[model samples]
Target chain A: MDLSTLTYIVVGATFLLYIGIAIWARAGSTGEFYVAGKGVHPVANGMATAADWMSAASFISMAGLIAFNGYGASVFLMGWTGGYVLLAMLLAPYLRKFGKFTVPEFIGERFYSKGARLVAVICLILASVTYVIGQMKGIGVAFSRFLETSYEQGLFIGMGIVFIYAVLGGMKGITYTQIAQYIVLIFAYTIPAVFISLNITGNPLPQLGLIGTMADGSGISMMDKLDMVVTDLGFKEYSTQLMGSKLNMFVYTVSLMIGTAGLPHVIIRFFTVPKVADARSSAAWALVFIAILYTTAPAVGSMARLNLMNTIQTGPVGEATANLEYAKAPQWFYNWEKTGLLKYEDKNGDGRIQYYNDKNPEMAAKAEAFGWKGNEMTKVDRDIMVLANPEIAGLPNWVIAIVVAGGLAAALSTAAGLLLAIASAVSHDVIKGMINPDISEKGELMASRLSMVGAIALAGYFGLHPPGFAAGTVAIAFGLAASSIFPVLMMGIFNKGMNRQGAIAGMIAGISVTMFYVFQEKGILFIPGTAEILQWEGYTKSWFMGISVNAFGAIGALVNFIVAIVVSKMTAPPPQHIQDLVEDIRVPKGAGAASAH
Target chain B: MDNNASKYWQANVRLVSILLVIWFVVSYGFGIILAEPLNAIKIGGVGLGFWFAQNGSIYVFLGLCFYYASQMNKLDKQFGVSED
Candidate 1:
């Protein structure tokens, strides 16, 4: 069968699996809806958390980002994974001990203020809604490419799938479904990587293949060869290129790490595990599962870039027969071209494609010498790099189809998790904790379902019009989480004196400053084109102290720490009972199951 | 609040601080701050620093978590606070 039909079959089967799991494990009560009855095994919760955390950005956009940015993308690799370390050590065990249904609920009760919970709820929604936009972007790109639907149509389909499983299943359904998704996404990610790695470096493991010798018998290493090839074509060396400033890279990594720890969806997964010990180990397990893809990604990225570059350049630069002829392009070229993601123009009427760094003035001068009008292979969308990898490596139809299913699984699972987080915060924290403290269990369940539907619809609307690309936009979500949520959560657990005034003030100050920096750079609430209104120049010139907006979260986090500390010192300490609550959550003894105050 | 409980919390805090320090050192230190110097020392044809950034630090993170879990288990038991 053709690729599209095969993709349709594979994707359809996965969707069916998700819906079936949703039906089997549908939430029947508030407990099931929120924390899955706190019955999840550590290993299972780990797998589900892995699926919940690795969104379309990781599966699709990250390798592309890595491929293009080179070593600097380590911020993502280390930042995203390193947070789990912090989570395992700092937050997970204590939060699990707290045994709450929602992150905001924990904050609300721990800080001894409904106002604090409301602040957390707002931060969670802002970050998560922004995050869903990135996933929606991924869904749109993936669906349009594989399913051959319009971007809008693809988003509608993605929304429909999420609606069915997430609204009905809640955390209970989403958990089981995500475990299956973890398997699908990890395999979909690794198989082609193994094949490509083997093809490139004679090593089956992409992690090893990255540093292994070239299969071309060039005698030089893969990294060395990449450095040589790309520099020959006027791009930076693959092994050591930084994003911009090293300071920006440093702050950026810190933001992502803290953000990863603070993400409400990820934290909630820890709540589902039965014990404090389980929370710790499940975090480890989540990292292990995630590391499988995270480690393979760089190899895929570097090797795919090598393949992509070689496909266009064909031979050494400055040679007459170097460029690939437009008419003689490979089938994968035509296939991706059909999606309008990869295209070429015969610049200078050479009937050949020149895909080089036209922005590099030195290469630009060289291209001018060669009578090239400009770089002709235009519109190589970074999101397509991983999705197109298997095909670019000439893997079989089944492999390509599996990648499609994997990308969707990654996107959909995380979207479901985020939507669940938003829905629970609305129903459990907002409605029950504040608005209707006496809400019936059945009423709460219904509210959860209704909010889940609303969340999906809202996410779908934002997905239809995203502010940034998949990965960069998702980084903003992390920044918000890092600056706002992470500091307060840490303070709540670690600092017993952290009162309601401190927690609330910290969240406001941290999130406001981070959002101020981001909005000033991107636009108000990322509406786009509004940055000019702020007289914003660009990152290179305007980034404060060489810190990009994504990197500004660390500064905001610092602000949060400082402000909360000052505010708490100025105000009264937390009550003795709240201090007692903190001391109780510190130990792993006599921890009951998930409970509401 | 009690001595034993306070000691357990203290031990947990120290462990987390130590592990977090290692985490920062591997990722930020070897990977970014001293990457250029570390790159001079090659590993399997790749720079040690680059490897740490892209690959090695992740392995370290995994080890840290598993180790923290095992050690925290020890602390819990020592403090007579294991969930069991």
Candidate 2:
């Protein structure tokens, strides 16, 4: 009946469903644990991949980021989804034909060098660990909001749920659970969007509603109205705002695209499907599923921004009733206020809430003339846009509950996927492949489970006390993956001349350069107060050639390509068998079934 | 490489090149580099550039995936390399 109770019921039900799937799909062998026994249908695998790929960032944070950032956020949408095309076309089918359990294994066998495999393992761990930290943050936030607990406690609970399914069923359980998660998250995401769209633009599809006529019969389109509303309040026009330098945006988009394709968690999902062709088709299907949310995001973002501004700035600036009185603020305002993410101070002793661009001196003068000292809403966390949307729009309690469940589903699914990637890289690639080559299948499975537990604990710790490097960490992770993993994998597949020396050198160069750039900007290993180069104040400019660290992956990747090619040419050619192995992976014939061992 | 296998691989490379060019054009070209020029042209309610960035490129990506898949399958069959 109440919001909390409804949220509890929905979130509790989803958790129970995940646990049930885990128990039912409990992996019996290494194959099942790692790749779901390679029996997953293409469509099902695609849905699973969509769930795996769309983390808390996509489900919870992306639309909120777009809401505030406007057109500049297109980098995220295009960058993230466009990578699937590269995956399907360049990597997935070939990797599927290779029939490997982990990415490192492919590198190990393809390059015919354990050292190259180890480099890949390190890169995979760094990127995946960084990614899991973001997921942990999402889980903590979603849990804190829905369960009304502290962020730390929410993180612990989220870690426990992931431990259950991931440790027990591995990829098999994660796959099925992710399918369920995809359904829950997509529905939760779209329902609020549809409602907002219809209410705002009289269009049912949010995508169309974003560009459709206003429901108020204002004759102007929704975009034009939103632009007028914000610009009228001294904010930039939503449709035309550039995020950063166009060069940075371009490079950022390229980094994210390659990073999405290179992520170990996403690439491994294709390994679960039945055939090479299935891998390609499944990537398409995954994008199709992801696109449903991606397309709706811009609509939800612009609409939510419009609604938010209207809520605070009710009319034209300088008008007597322009700002909403604190006493008359909506229930959603009070609700988010309790979380401390939304706060207001009665500056100028004003009884009303003034949400405006106080940083603009011109606007400040106008605000001063209206007896407003400064903006009262001191902190409005961008993350609250989606979570608070249903309540903001006066939707029923069930919709809010579904959103809570959806956010948790997204965080949990992606967390499980990342944990799996970490676990497999450690257990299969490190432990069995190198540490104890004679490890039994049973021993390996146990190691994988143990690694999952360890990975979850580490991720939870980072979530609780996110590093100073936490700002834009997800983009950094993407950069690392794009720079290090994607290039090597592409070279390994497409270039027969690629040898072990080249692959290893390229990975090291790419990851180290990307890390150096990122660490110089963010901090060393994201430890606070460790940045050698201050971003804005340093004598030497922080970025190189006007490129932000987040966008330097393309440069790092270029360096890798050049270094690898040069090194390979200097070194001996790969052994004849290794050349044949590359040739073997290029074709679809005689591709044996995924091994059960 | 055998003749059929080489032929199939060539065909695959050709398709990928074409699709990738389209991908580059839609996303990096219309979406970013030429966004200003393209924005001068309106679509539905948004600018053509914004539409390409936000919506059109994604649809094209989907089409490319399916097209690549089907074409590859046909090529695989022609080369007698379709997996059993």
Backbone clash tally for model 1?
0
- Over the stretch A1-597, how does candidate 2's per-residue lDDT look in tens digits? 888888989999998998898899999999999999999999999999999999988988899989998888999989999999999999999999999899999998888889999989988998898888988898888877787888888888888888888999999999999999999999999999999999999999998998798988778888888888877666777887887788888988998899899999999999998889899899999999999999999999999999999899887888877789999999999989998989999887768888888888877888788888887889999989999999888899999999999998998999899999999999999999999999989999999999988998899889988877666778888888999999999999999999889989998998888888877766777777777643456534335778877788888888889899999999999998988888888888877777733
lDDT for each residue of candidate 1 in A344-455, tens digit (9 for 90 to 100): 7887897888888888999999989888888887889887899889988999999999999999999999999999999999999889988898999899999999999899
Clashing pairs in 2: none
Docking class of 1: high
Give the per-prediction TM-score of chain B.
0.97, 0.94
Candidate 2 — which residues are off by over 4 angstroms?
A533-542
Assess each prediction's global lDDT (C-alpha) against the native.
Answer: 0.90, 0.89
| Cα RMSD, each candidate | 1.7, 1.6
Report how far residue B57 has shifted in candidate 2, in Å.
1.1
DockQ of 1: 0.88
